[model samples]
Target chain A: MHVTEDDLLKFALETCDDAEAQAIGEHVAACDECRERLALLRRDIAIIAGVQPEAERIPLPFRSYRPSVWRAAMRMAAVLLVGFVGGLAVSRWVCRCPVTVVPQYGASAARAIAASPQAVTPAPPVDLAATSQ
Target chain B: MVYPKGTYEVSDDWRDLDQARHGDEAAWRRLMERHLSRLVALALMMTGSPEFAQDAAQEAFVRLLKANPAPEQGTLRGYLTTIVYHLALKENRRSARQQNVENSSLEDDSPSALESMVRSEREWLVVGAIRALDDAQRTALVLRFYGEHTYEEIAALTGVPLGTVKSRLFYAVKQCREWLKEKGVFKECM
Candidate 1:
């Protein structure tokens, strides 16, 4: 029977003890299929190693980098500056020309007051003098 | 491989050793600066907790200094890797024993949403797969690949028989490969 997958992997990693190594090596030498599997296992070993934990530990200068206090303060300052500028622009626009309030009709409306000549309504005059007498 | 094949190339590793041996704090600091991150990563692999991992790594370095007066004549990287690995593995076992209930809950049959979120990014995908492995398998895998130790060294370091080490490594790699394949990492990334 062919060697087990465990044996093949061990053989590929060169971890088999002397006797095991010799036996596996002999079997692999005699078998083309085992040889191919061993090659594949060897490749797998390398691939696993590539993702090994230590591989991620390269000393990156900015790895533990937090934004400097000054930088953060500067960012806040910039935000405040932008907000202030925006608020000033809005207030200026609003002050420059308020929207016209057309009271009688169109778009925005309100009840007309007698302050306008057109708003005064006519009513019948009573005989005040005769009533008083 | 993250650790290069053979003794890790540290020229100052030896050059500064004499000073480090003579109670020079600066020399020792230099050594620690050189090797601490790698040691921490290895420990993190064995011990999942960053807190415990950091402790294990630091303890390993201190133990090497205090425990072995005449430290083994090899690359400092090798000794540090070995020490930190052992420390981390011990912590892992202790924690595993105490937190069996909590850990059992974590090992549910189906993958959790957190586990299955390893989409697109190969690093995250591989990390998830590695995390999937049980402690023993993960230890064997990390020691072999990251530590770059030979079978004999791994066996000796782990205090396990060569056969056990070989088998653990085999299964570890096999499982990792299966997980990687299942996630389509091979086709998508490399």
Candidate 2:
């Protein structure tokens, strides 16, 4: 039986379980070509495994992270501050009017009221003399 | 020091995560202290850079805090690793884009100067070999070996089919083996 490069490669990668691995191992030990292929595969895996970066130091507690509290507080504070400022601006816009415009309108309204006699009195008398005449 | 009730006691991580979800700052802090290191290592392995790893891990924790914590439903490590994996991938994409732009601007066609500064010959060779792997294969290898995630966990986190995950692992190991052999490391080891 002939074993292709793919079969040997797959076996070398340990994709096979105990039985297949054992078969491939037995065959490779006897076959020079398969043995060379296994050797090459082993070397590459080793290089890749070796290339992995060293285990890094565990990260300190996030609380220990500098400026964390301040940053979080600042973020919350900024949001609150914006909300507060926005509310204040809206309230101010709604409540107050320009003094000049208010008085000008007020004066005109007052003059109109004063000019209309019926506005000050309950009812103006009709011209009884003219009616009689 | 007078310890507050329930503050000094070390509870199970899932319990702590649940408590933290319910607004227990101390529980959250304790959980972070316990798991931050492993998370960082995983992030670094995934991102291939310490600074990016740090940021990614931090971002993952932040997301965890903001998320509805359901520690009972899954392992904390799985949850954290999933978050870290996504953040690391995002950072990788961002950096890759930046690198592409930089590489495009540079006139020199030789091997990158960044590639030259890895210091250790073996380390450089390994990195080069890792870079040669496809993204999925590289991710699977890093998560499986470096991050120490089980196949099931990796499959869940990566959303790849179980068989696909296994196949990727097999091929990745194979590729690594071949590369190392080419570099003569395996012969030396034998």
Candidate 3:
């Protein structure tokens, strides 16, 4: 049987699967009418494709700051800013911080005593061993 | 039949496009020279406005250079056309909104618009024939023939199923064929 226009269209588009392509291929090779029809379809395709109007050279990256370009750049910049802030927060949550909100005095009780505005006198460390004995 | 692979000799497109991605100005120019006209044509088909078409084409290149969005399934040309197509649609919407507000005529005063007005009779006839189609069919037809895209690429770009794309292609070609025959330009051009 002769191929339909749909079959020929798919063949022209190269959309047929391999087996169907082979079948169409054998048919078109042997059928003069199908071959001529394919040629005409190709010409129509060319007429459709070939109507491009001529153009001058478009200045490339020289004018890269066009709306679309910087708009994307701004978008990427915004994404990076969000990522950095998010990562900082996540890292802070995951890791231990060396410093704390409240200050702790170590071993320098005298300095702590002097530094404290409410201090009357220094409190000595209790000797637990002597007390136990 | 030994079909021509693509209407454009786009072999160097990938290599130059790769270089353009990394700040190569000359390669970028090469890519632009090779593809800009076709992209502009696509934009024109999509938007029907010459100025918007030019802007859309430039925007596509800018997106390519800046965003560097590689296609997962189609070629770089297809990717570029997809960008132009979307940009054209967006710009068309914005234009429509402004027209709605200001109530201006749809005349485009761009030089390209004037140039297209005086194009050859055959070109005008072809454009008229294409414009006669419905929006969906026209888009499918332009992408398939002018973009030289496969059915898969057209389907992906249009976000339609394979069968739908095939049907659109069938109706679009059938309409254009009938138009050409009616115009008596088919036999004359051939």
* Top candidate (DockQ): 3
After superposing candidate 3 on the true structure, give the runs of residues whose Cα lies further than 4 Å from its correct spot. A1-7, A14-22, A63-133, B1-11, B21-25, B70-74, B97-119, B188-190
Off by over 4 Å in 1: A1-8, A17-40, A52-133, B1-12, B19-34, B62-75, B93-120, B188-190
How does candidate 3 fare on TM-score? 0.65
Q: Is candidate 1 or candidate 2 better by lDDT?
A: 1
| lDDT by residue (tens digit), candidate 1, A81-109 | 99999999997766655344332443322
* lDDT (0 to 1) per candidate: 0.62, 0.61, 0.69
Residue range B84-149, candidate 1, lDDT tens digits: 876765776677344332253324322343234223356455655666787677777877776767
- DockQ metric for all predictions: 0.07, 0.11, 0.17
A best-first ranking of the candidates according to their TM-score comes to 3, 1, 2
Better of 2 and 3 by DockQ: 3
How well does each candidate reproduce the native contacts, as fnat?
A: 0.19, 0.21, 0.26
Please, what are the lDDT tens digits per residue for candidate 3 over residues B1-190? 2234335555577778777665677988888777777877677666666677777778777777676655554478877887877786677677744322122222433435736642566665566567667778888878876566777777887899987887887677777777777887687222
In candidate 3, position A37 carries an lDDT of 88
lDDT digits (tens) for residues B1-190 of candidate 2: 0111123333387777666655567877677666565566556545556566566777777776656457455666667777888888887777744333223222221234323324466665565455556778878876765455677777887899877887997777667557656886455322
| Candidate 3 local lDDT, residue B105 | 24
Interface RMSD of 1: 9.7
